[model samples]
Target: MAGGSNTNNYGGDLSEVVRQLAVVAQQLARSSINNGDAQGKLFKKVAQSTPPTYQGELDPTILQNWLREFEKLFGAVGCLENSKVGCTTYYLKGEADLWWQQNEATIRALPGFNWTKFQDKVRDKFYPSFLLKQKAEEFSNLKMEEMSVTKYYTKFIELSRFAKESIAIEKAKARKFESGLTIDLQLKLCGQVFETLDEVYGRAAHLYALELKK
Candidate 1:
């Protein structure tokens, strides 16, 4: 009777251990399925957006535009921060693809690697100093002579990237933009205390419309 009681106790303990193992397995399986489902949804959204492929163009404007498009797509789809570099790099083709394949290990090994870091790497490779300086000069010489206020504003925003320090502050940005407007618009907008670039643009546009009517 004592031997039988000992055997029964051992069997019960074994059974409990098996049950706990089964529960852990089931939990792991469910977690894996949830992760897979999330990845599938993200891929489907990215496909629908038809993200552009990059083929190692050296043009700063082209590179900038490609980066801009991806940024927009990432925002629109609610892309995970950890996944942005993977998604953007997957679109690289030809020379760009080869370049990434070579440097990927090193880039990935860097501390705290992310989308911004990836962007910096790409710019470092493609955006040469001469091209950057040329872009800055273009921004410095920008004027609203022939272009409408809307068009001038668009170009101003686009070229401002190359000359960031010139308009680093909101007041400076407003002043830089105001100075670029046509002489007539400048004369009209001279004594105002505009706090933001948008405010200056709005006032200039309104005045421009009035001048057109006259």
Candidate 2:
């Protein structure tokens, strides 16, 4: 049964959310593994056994990078026994997830940016968070020292809100495309991906709607 502290992973055990959420990605990769046995090893080698472009988004370079980072940032067991007083693993996980979320927001909030440029910005933001946590592991400042405590607190709260909201929206999109789940897990998975894109594009739709209302 799918269950966890829906109250939230307060202790930074992000694996629950990541595991539940990555059900789609994990299943697809697994399918490739299964096919490798049946269709010979050659076909199994290619992750995307098809042409890599649709509409305007190319596969496995930009969007795929963000997807993989999101999985790693949010979808793992975060535990660090770094005995640095209060340098808990929970804190590390929170920063990583928060980093993933801010980029998600930046990408979503861009109204007219090129997709490639948008992706580059996401990767750019990811590295800083990675470095901050690495520095924190060494009893150094988590970089919160650079800002006033109030500002740091506010930043944490803002990122926390974004991550939670984004995950909820993602889950809602997943549920929407769940109808054909029985026909084939692959199609159902594609449906979920498209559903997510719908939400991403819906932000623009919503803005245009508001402009019309005005």
Per-residue CA lDDT of model 1 for 15-123, tens digit only, reads 9999999999999999999988887788789878898888988778778999999999989999999878877888999888999999999998999989999999988
**Clashes per prediction?**
0, 0
Score residue 184 of candidate 1 by CA lDDT.
85
Stretches off by above 4 angstroms in model 1 are: 1-23
What does the lDDT read for residue 188 in candidate 2?
Answer: 25
lDDT per residue, candidate 2, 51-128, as tens digits? 122122222233343344433432232312221112111122344446544555555466654434544554464435
Query: Model 1: how far is 161 from its true place, Å?
Result: 1.6
For candidate 1, list the clashing residue pairs, or say none.
none
Best by lDDT: 1
Query: Candidate 2: which pairs clash?
Result: none
Per-model TM values vs. the true structure: 0.80, 0.16
